[model samples]
Structure formats: C-alpha cells, structure tokens
Target: MNRRVSELGERGLIRRLREKFPSLHSIGDDCAVLPGIRCPVVTTDSFFEGTHFHRWWAPPQILGRRLLEAALSDIAAMGATAKWFFTALSVDPGIGVNWIEGFYQGLTEREDVILAGGETVRGERLGITLTVIGEGEDRDTILRRSSLHPGDNLWITGLLGRALDAPAKLEKAGGLSGKDLKPRSGFLSSAELEQLRAFLQPRAELELGIKLRKAGIRCAIDISDGLFSEASHLSLESSVDTVLEIDETLFFDSVKDNPLAASAAGEDYVLLFGAPVGLEFSSVGCSKIGRAETGNGEMTIFLDGERVSINAKGYDHLGVRK
Candidate 1:
C-alpha cells in the first residue's frame, strides 16, 4: 500500500479522481466559487484510519458524524453557517457497502449541510476527506490566533475533559469483549446520556459564535486542542501575553488538573473566543478565565494566582495510534 509511485501515475490518479466528480462551478482551481454569498469561506480537511479515528472503537456512522463535526467546527470558528460539502472517499477491500451507507446516514443529519457531490475509489486503506463551504456576514467573520487585542477577555464554551477522560463504561464483565464499549442505557446509571452525547457528537457553535460576533467580539477560535495550547496560540499570534484562570468548579467529577493533558487532547471542538472586558452574554454559559496582556510574550495560566506546569501538548496526527 505504501509503494513508491511514478510522478505521472500520481497525476493520472488525481485526474481520474477529478473526472469522477464533476465541478458544478468554476471560480479558481484552488477555491470554490460561491455566487450567492457575498462573503464566502472555503475549508478543506482530511481524516484517516488509525490516526483521526480508531476503527475498532467507533462505528462507521459515529465515525462519519465525527468527520462532519470536525469540519463544521472550522466553519463555526469563523462564525459561518455551513451550506454544503463535497466529499472524497477511498477505501480498502475490508470496507463494505453497508458501512459506507451508514456513514452517509450520519452525515445527512446535520442541519443546513448537504453533500453536493463526491468521489470514491478502491485503495489499500480506508480514508475520507471533505471540503466544506460556508458563508458568514462581513461583520461576523471571525479569525483564529489573529485579531486578538490587548485587554480582551478570553472565554471558552462548555466544560472540558469530561468526554475524553471518563471511561467508556462496559456492559459486561469480560475485558476482551468488544460489546463492552457499545452504547448502553444502564452502564453508567449515574451519568446522563445527554452529557456523553456532546463528546460523541459535538455540534458546531455557529449560532452562538455568530451572535457573539454580532454582539461585538472580534477574535476567536474553536477549542479543538483544548484550552491550554489554543490559549498560547492566541497569545503568540496577537503579540500579547495572557493569564488563563481556569474555573475548576466547571469540571466533571472525573476532571483532573493536568495542564498538558487538557491542552493536548483534541476533539472537544468548543468555541474559545475573546471579547472586550465588561460584556454580558447571558445567552451562553461562558467563564472568563484569561486576559490578554502586552508586557510578557508568553501564556501564563494561573490556578488561584499561582503558576504551574503541565505535560499536555496539542494533538499530533502522527502521534495518534490504534
């Protein structure tokens, strides 16, 4: 599967893939043209087996839903509403027709998103990539790492660490059984299914972010790499320093205070945004944990006013293993 290929063969492969999927419109070779939207944004991403996901851990439908959510998070970060998506899928002989159909079923459930078209091919391993096109108003377009300013209050939506830290409760006692991790109503009697639902399928914060932008926010990013790494990115890009005061009370029962763990673990996909101090947003549950400063050129997170060290770094795609 990893054999070296001639340059001509690679070009031929790309040409054939393009031939299978017809282009509906031509804006540029790199960017998709959106005639209806005055302000349009195009984003492209890919997910691969044993990296973006573990096939043994997630069902095909759930895997598909995760793929869609990851893309939508990017749109939401820009305060844009998703319009449509184009998908390209390649699979090894191990995949079946039923699995592909189930994948599409989950993808179709998202609001305001339709699969305009896609391509398919037979390969040595399973993989899928999607390019999502979305639209936002001129005022509502947000940016990541950039656009931050001095004295802006940093806020993150939703609680962190619950979904990933909590163990997948088993239905049976046998350790070897694959059925142990399957969704069960009674496995964790004390835990609410709705809470786990967010981790499993993170809905984009499009409306909330757009509303925040309309309410006068200028800088923002989605918390895919958790709070620690993203906060540093914001500080570095905006040419400012930040003091992150994490709200310890918002954590789930299983929450722990390993800073590196919090920062490096991806897939939370919540919005982390900056607003001017003294703004009131009663609609969304946000906690003001940090402030941008200009004196120091580093991120210093304070827990009850003291600096601490942690081991978590952001997710590296190659680092994730089956």
Candidate 2:
C-alpha cells in the first residue's frame, strides 16, 4: 500500500502530476499552445481551500469550475479565446477519488479543457493552481495597466456586490453546480444566494472585447480586483484621476444601500474598459460610471464627488483573512 501521500514535498507533488502528461511544449515560456492558432497569450492563477473559496460554502464541482474560470478570465481580459490549460493540485488526507472526480466533472461542464498535467498529495490543506493558454493577434490581445490614455471614459460590465453579499441567491439561481447545499461561510442570505446564482459563473467576454477592439476601443482592464482598485491602477498607469457615479439601478437590486461596496468588491468577473467617450459596443451593456482626467498626484477614486479609499482586497491567497 502506498503509505499516505503526506510525505511528498511540493516538488514531489508536482512531479507526480507532471508525469501523467506527455511533454508537448517547453515551460520556459509564460504559456504553451498547440497548432490551433498563432500568437498565444498565456495567464495563470491559483485557488486554495481557505484562500480562494471556502470548502463549506461550495461543492467540489463549483470549486473546480471556478478554478478554470479564474484563469480563463485573465486570458479573456487580453481579448483572447482560451485554447487549453494546465493544472496542479495539493490536498490532504480528507480528499478521496470521488472528490477529485467531481472536481473534473465541474471543470468539463464549464468548457472542453484539456489537462496538460497535474498531481495529488497528502497535506494539511487543499489547493489548486491553473495556467491557461490562448491565441490572438496584436490588436485583439488588449492593453495592460500601462496602456490607458488620457481623456478616456471608464466603463464597467454586469452587476456588482451580487457575488460576495448573496451566495444563497446564486445557489437558487443555479449559479453553483452539483448538489445544492447551504453556504459554509455564512456571508450570504437566502435571497442573496438566489441572486448570486443568477450572477456569478465562469464567463468569457472575448467575443465582445474583440468587437470593441475592432471599433477602436483601446484602454481596458478586467474587474478582477474590486472596480475601485482596478480603476486606481488605470488612473495611476495613465496618469489621470477618475470620477465614479453610483448607478443605483445597475447594482444587484437587493443591495442598494452601499452600491459602491459591491462595485468595489471583487470576484464579479466583469471587464472594465477605458475608451474615448461615446464609442458604441455590442453584446454586453456597459455603464459609463466615470471619466479620466490628467493629474500629477496618486490616483484617486471619487463616489458622488467624495473621495473613497479601497485596497486591492479581492480574494488574496496568502492575504485574505479567514
């Protein structure tokens, strides 16, 4: 009998999963791709039990699906279509074959992802890391923090605060996959869970982004960090100040008291873009909540003419407080 896997170190754990996949491409590059398309864009992310998601709130399936979504979102942020992915996992004795099977089931349901390789081990906690590979041309890959220009309007997609405030609503709305269960974190109420279910899912807006890019839309950022932090990055990068107008109607109808918090909250998986005022976009509806102005000081966030401060407090792995 294989004496429990707990003895394996991190490198040993990774080697086990690596052996499963045949070496196809070099890992020296940031990302790897097959012959489907040219000019690949690569991004990676890591999700763990306490850091990314709570084991009690979501099932193994939703956890697995979201893992792929988090990595793919980075690819989509660059306006690229995800072609393939590689994954690595770490776990403790509590995990079993059934749990891993369900995790893959959730991943497969989200998209046809081909696993390059991965591994398993016995440890004190469970964690998952994924690297996604995508393909796109120069214009379609979008710009990073340094690319935003002056005189651009800031826009955000979808509703906010719906994910962190209301987990029960999402559960009801089918936001979560596999068998339904009560939220382990106790952060979401029954109504909120239903609403969140309708909202949070593994979504890619690559199609919409490409269309906008072709239409001459330039500066953009994915709302991975709270909109407040992301906007700050844009402003700092472009050397501009931002003004955000709170649209009560645009927020999840249930949490209206502090809509900015929802907007400032993370994990909405929405895309934020900066472009010349009045450029038209198709598919997803965008809200023009702010404007950018040339400035000499640190980036500032304004809500209804008042300065609001927000840290990049969205789902940090070693940083989030349990």
Best by TM-score: 1
In angstroms, the error of model 1 at 279 is 0.5
TM-score between model 2 and native: 0.76
The reply for model 2, stretches above 4 Å from the true place, is 1-33, 139-141, 166-191, 198-202, 297-322
lDDT of 2: 0.62
Q: TM-score for every candidate vs. truth? A: 0.76, 0.76
For model 2, residues 112-135, the per-residue Cα lDDT tens digits are 556644445455788877877777
lDDT of 1 by residue, 106-157 (tens): 6666757866666666667678888988887874455556878888888877
Minimal lDDT window, size 10, model 2: 313-322
Best by lDDT: 1
